[model samples]
Each structure stands twice: as structure tokens, then as C-alpha cells.
Target: MNPFYFVFGRSANMVLILIFFFCPVSPSYGYDPLDPKGNITIKWDLLQSNSDTNDVKVSLLNFQLYRHIEQPGWKLGWEWLGKEVIWSIQGAEATEQGNCSRFKGGQLPHCCENKPLIVDLLPGAPYNIQTSNCCKGGVLSSMIQDPTKYAAVFQMNIRAGGAADSDFDMPQNFSLGVPGYTCAKPVQVAPSKYSSDGGRRWTQALGTWNVTCIYSQYQASTSPKCCVSLSAFYNDSIVHCPKCSCSCQGLPGSKCVKFGETPSLLQQVKDPNQEPPSIVRCTQHMCPIRVHWHVKQSYKEYWRVKITVNNLNILKNYSGWNLVALHPNLKSLTQVFSFNYHPLNQYGHINDSGMFWGVEYYNDMLLQEGEVGNVQSEMLLHKDEGIFSFREGWVFPRRILFNGDECVMPPPDDYPRLPKNTARAASFTLSIIFSPLFMLLIIFAC
Candidate 1:
């Protein structure tokens, strides 16, 4: 009834329902109490985050402000501003190689890198992360000294001698995902303790952690809206997805074709020009799907592909038709994350080529002859990854509206879907600096 519903509106993400047992990997490390000394440095090398090498001022300060802090989730735009972030606190130091990324202010997932996160004892403190759940003690301390420059200062409450009478404790809120977004599983905590100096010095404990996933509610702007019930976008009336070739549940006839049903005969465009070496303008030489496409619209940290109905044959009231994109020469294809309609399976592969298909319906009204009907979808693409989101979809100029009479591919000065192409993965090197105290130290705060 609303414009958004007509176009693509926010749809519930397919979570909870599709959940299977997410087996937690056993942790190799645990908590051990250390002398509440001058300054203790814990290298929290976080994963799936980016640092600003571009913004020299902020990037430089980040080193000073968050010393020894690994896997910092703060973004260039001061992203972690008001978001609630949680860390699994046990006394165990992360394996030199196996550190997981913290949640990226509701943008990313928490997981081990292409490299698995390995946590073990902290040098002399080889305490196994003992707690069955993580960080159950209570809120220790936070460093929200300046909201303007830091969001990573949110929470870190693991202290010694808490109500649990256990040496280790996680913040009161042991899990991530608050309100609109929530964790799909129950959160647990553990503690590790090692006593030296005859129990005077001890490796108080925090618990071992169970890896889990978070579910985020739909935000401000969702895109390229489509019927995303089962990885198949539906126009319903057109009922032409899965192509009736791979598999289908619909009936047979003009409605359902025998296997290998060819589309209504139309002169197929010449073989699509070889995949362009780099992202470029769509040309007449390019396929009609490419020419009729527009910017992969940017929507809050993500992007979506938008296409205009160039075919007048799609007369108004047309329903149940799937939009297809084929890239004959696509070489590398993998998804960094799992989404509903944009999975690798949805993009069928045969030999070296592949085709991505989605169903779209035009306003439920006739796409009056020649009157271009623009259809947007709910397929959200990560921003930095948007330009390369599709191995072969046409790249367009962002911002400008689609003018039916445009002659050039990206019009003129329009840039690729992603406005800026900075690395989302920031790099950090450990340069242990000595403090005036003359005692060894850990750094994570200014």
C-alpha cells in the first residue's frame, strides 16, 4: 500500500528460524589474576575492523589513545558513538594468531579471520579460560572520556574479587546485541585463576567463551526490495524464478516449462562483452541489463543494486518475472557474509560462468509503455565491497537520477557505487614502548 512496500521495504532477516546448533570451539586459554600493577598491556588485536591511515590526525592519536588495543572497532566517522559492544573476558590471553574481531558497531560479524583465533596462556600465566560462559562477574571500568573521538571506549568490566567470589568476571551485560538487535543464543561466562606469592598474587579467572552470532533489526534505508522469503525474490504474479531449470514447486504449462525451457524467443544480445578489466561505464555493446542499470545505491554503510525497466514488453501489471545477471568470465566468487537473497547458491554457476537471478514486480501498475519503471531491491551490499559486489553488473554514477535519454554509460562524473574505497581492514603493528614507571605495562587506553 505504501511506496516502500511497492518498491522494496524492510523485510525481516531470516534468522532464529534457520538456526542450527552452532557448536562452540573449546578455548585454549583462560583467566589468571595478575598483580594490580602500574600498567598492564593486553594486545587486543581485534578482527574485521578498519583504522584511518587517511585521517593522519585521528589515526596517529588512535595509537596513543588505544595502545595495545587489538581489533579496535571504531570507524573513521566516529561510528562506535552510542552502540553497545561486548567482549568475552577471561584471564587467558588470546593465542598470538587466533584473535577474533569485535562487532563493528552493528555493521559486521564477530569471527576468526581466514586465520582461526587461537588463545592460550599469557606467557607465565598459562591459565585456561575456565568459565563455561564468559564475563559473568560485573562491569569493571569503561573509558568513555570523549564520545567525540572514541566509541571503542564503551565497555570492559572484568575485575578481581566480584560478588561471584570468583577472581574473574565479565561486565554485567555479557552479550552483544541490545534492543533492536539481539543475540540469538544465551550468553555464558567463565573465570581463570592462578595464585602465586602464596595466594597473594593470583591469576583471577574469567570464563571460557562460546562463539555466537547476532541478529540486527532493519535500519533506515533498505534496498532493491524483492520477495526474499527463500533466497528467491518473487514478483509472485510472474512466478519465474529458479528458472524451472534448477528446481521449482509451481505447476506445469506456459506457467511451468519442461526442464531446460528457453525464454520466450527474442534475439539474445551478442555475447556480453568480455568482463571489463576494471569497473567502467555500461556501453550499448554491453548487455541491455547493464545499460538499463543505475548506481548500486548507497544506503547506510551498505549499498543496493538498482535497475530501470528498459523493456516496453514488460507492460504494466507484469508480475512473476526474475531479473537475471550473467557474468561469463567471473573468476573469483565468495561471500564475506551470509545474507538471504544474495547467497552463492542464488547465483547459479555452470562451468566457468554464473548467473544471478531475482524476481521484481513493477508498482503492481502497468509499466505504461516506455514509461520507465524503476525497481529497487533489499539485497544489501557492503560499502567497500559494493563496486565489486557483482562480477558483471554495470557500474553507474552515484547521485544523479536516471534520465531515460542518457547516452553515456555513467553519464559524466558519477563515481562507482561505493563513494570512497578505503580499506575497511586497518593494520596495526606492535611497537612496545617503555613507560617512565620502569615496570612492564599493558596498553588499551590513553
Candidate 2:
């Protein structure tokens, strides 16, 4: 025997297997294998200018399939290549107006900062300041969910007095100021086209450039936000989410409070001003969100499943939240209750994926930690007798995603297993034992 195997024995192999399944793995940044072509592109279109200033229409297009900008939405910033100042802006505004003491005449520039941070206007912005697709408070949905809401646009006029021969250089050091994203330098592309009067007339930009950005979960520098638990009807075993599935207690941004441990902590959680994704009820898994999957019932032709989502973080409410499950049985789904269901057939002809969310004005907004901190739904799927089996964790979902982030699932060994003396096993043995007698009786009757 090899010395390594002789010394470690079979127990050592089990330890290695657990490590392979539970331990965190380092992931590469800037590319996602699942969504390889997904990216957010910033398009800057310089419109035809007859005056001294340059008019530009900047649009942020979300080309990603599932990722979206959530509340307290995106902040876009860039450094000017030249001494360019914003003369006027519509649909968006600069966060700060820097010192403009050098210029002493005429209408003052809207902003004099060399590197101004821009943010989208709210829905109720004045009519004079509004433009098409201008104000959504920087919230851009995923292209796959809603293509019409996947882009944000604004128009600005730049006064570059120091430019030579009316030439404008591309800006440098572009940033979304949101974590997990890094942008590439702007590349000149063919001019973008525009349609006016309901597509009757066409217009084109004088010049166009694009900046592409990609997201990396590791670069976000945050722990996972969600986890999963599982249960079944035939077994008493309930598999809770793994301990410390997201982060360990007492770590930064993992603060929690036990019942009556800190009375003030509850008050702090109730405070509207507190920061989010922390200040949760204490639990073994320090995740903000928990998704529970329960095999509710089994019938001759159909199986029922119940899904519940819990919000542990008291400081935040999830708006437009959604849950996705990958299971072989989802293709035969017959009915769903309470929540809205949609098939996400990202891969053609493979229908093993489905997405679920809450109904409008009812449970759409998952409330903070309280009596109403969760949303649940029931699903009925037609059982496929050809391959359907409850053994070896076949009934549970293969993967679960909450708000586009995959949740951590329990190990396969931890799933509920059928008892040796269960009703099904006993029936199988009885049938085998009586088969000969039953066959003889059938021959006599024939």
C-alpha cells in the first residue's frame, strides 16, 4: 500500500471530500462562465453640434441577462481628458458643483468639476429637466427581464475651451462607483442611430464610443447573501442550511442579536437610517436571506412543493425580488399558487429552469425582519414515472438562486433519506412474496 493511503486510511478520504464540497474556492474575475457574453456597455454619442459646445447623449445599457441595479442605484463617474466643464445638463445632474471662480461672465456652468459624478433623477423630476428614458433614479433592470427598462439615458453639453481644432479626447478612469464592476477604456465605434416621431424619421450621431464593464462576485468583497434548507414528506430529517454558510459571526458586516440579548439592537434595526445587509436576528448561518424547500405531498400522478423565502436582515426590504430553481421536474409543472411563475429557458429546448416572484401589491415587496418578513408559494408538478425518484436527493432542486445570486445548498449526504422499514419498502417485499400465489389464482380464474 502507498504510505499516504496507509497512514490516512478511509477516514482521510472522507475529510478531503467534505473539504472539496464545503470549502470556498477562489474564482477568476472579469468573466462568468455561465453568462460568458454578459456585460454592461456605456454608449456615448456625440450629436451634431452647430455651436461652440459639444452635445452628447450618454446611455447606460445593461446587457447582462439577470443582474440588475438595486435600490440606491448606480453612480457613474469619469475624469475629463481635457479641461471640460458641463455647461448644461438635462435628465441628470452632477452631485457637486466645483469652484468656478476663474470664469467671470455670462450664465454660469452647471458644474465646473474636472471629474464630476452623475446620478439619475427621480421619477417626479420637473418636466423641463426630463428627457426620454432619463429618470429612473439610476435603476436599470436586467435585459432578460425587461428590455424596455434596461437602459438609462441623459444629455449634457460640454464646454471644452482648451480643446484644439474642436477635437475632444476620450475621458479616462471611468467608474460606476458601485462595487464588483470594472470598466474598460472607451473604444470608438460606428455612430449610434436614433428614431424620431415614432420611427418615421431617423437620426444618427456624429460620433460614438463605448465603455464595457463586467462584474466579479469576489471583487464585491462581500459574503453570500442567501442560503437554502431542505425537507421531505417521507422522512423526518430536516436539513437546515450549513452553519456559517455566508460569514462567521463577529466578522465585519455580520453583526447579529439574540432574543433579548440586545434590546437596543432591535431599535437600531428599526431605525430607517441604519446601513443594510447587517443587523440581523442571530442564527447559525449568518445570511440575510434563507430559502426553504419542502416536499409537501406526493400523489400517484403529481407532487407538491412549497418554497418559502425569509428575510433576516431587519434593515432592508427586497423589492422586485425573485427566486429561481433548477430541477428536472420543473418542465412538467402543472400549477403554481400565490407567486408569479415564468420559465427561464435560457438554453434552447432545455426546459429545466423556472423563475418565481411575488404578485403585485401583495407580497411583491419582501418586508424586513418581522411578522411579514417572508414570502412563500406552492407548486404542483406532474410526476414523470420514467425517471422520477426520491432516492439520492433526486427530489430536491439542483440549484437555487435568489435575486440572481446563487444560494449555498446543503451537502448531498445531509439530505433526508428514506427509512429502511418505510411503507414503500414493506409493500415492495409483500408484493414479491405473494407474486406466485397471485399468479396461480389468476390462472385458475382464467
Q: Which of the numbered candidates is closest to the native, going by highest TM-score?
A: 2
Per-residue CA lDDT of model 2 for 216-239, tens digit only, reads: 776775677789999999888899
Q: Using lDDT as the measure, which candidate wins? A: 2
Give a tens-digit lDDT track for model 1, residues 111-219: 2223212222222332344322122111111111121322122112211111223222211222221121121222343433446578877754223322232222122
User: What would you estimate as the lDDT of candidate 1?
Assistant: 0.25
Error of 1 at 318 (Å): 35
In model 2, where do residues sit more than 4 Å from their true spots?
Answer: 1-26, 161-165, 261-277, 421-446
Which lDDT value does model 2 have at 315?
71
For residue 265, give model 2's deviation from the true position in Å.
7.1
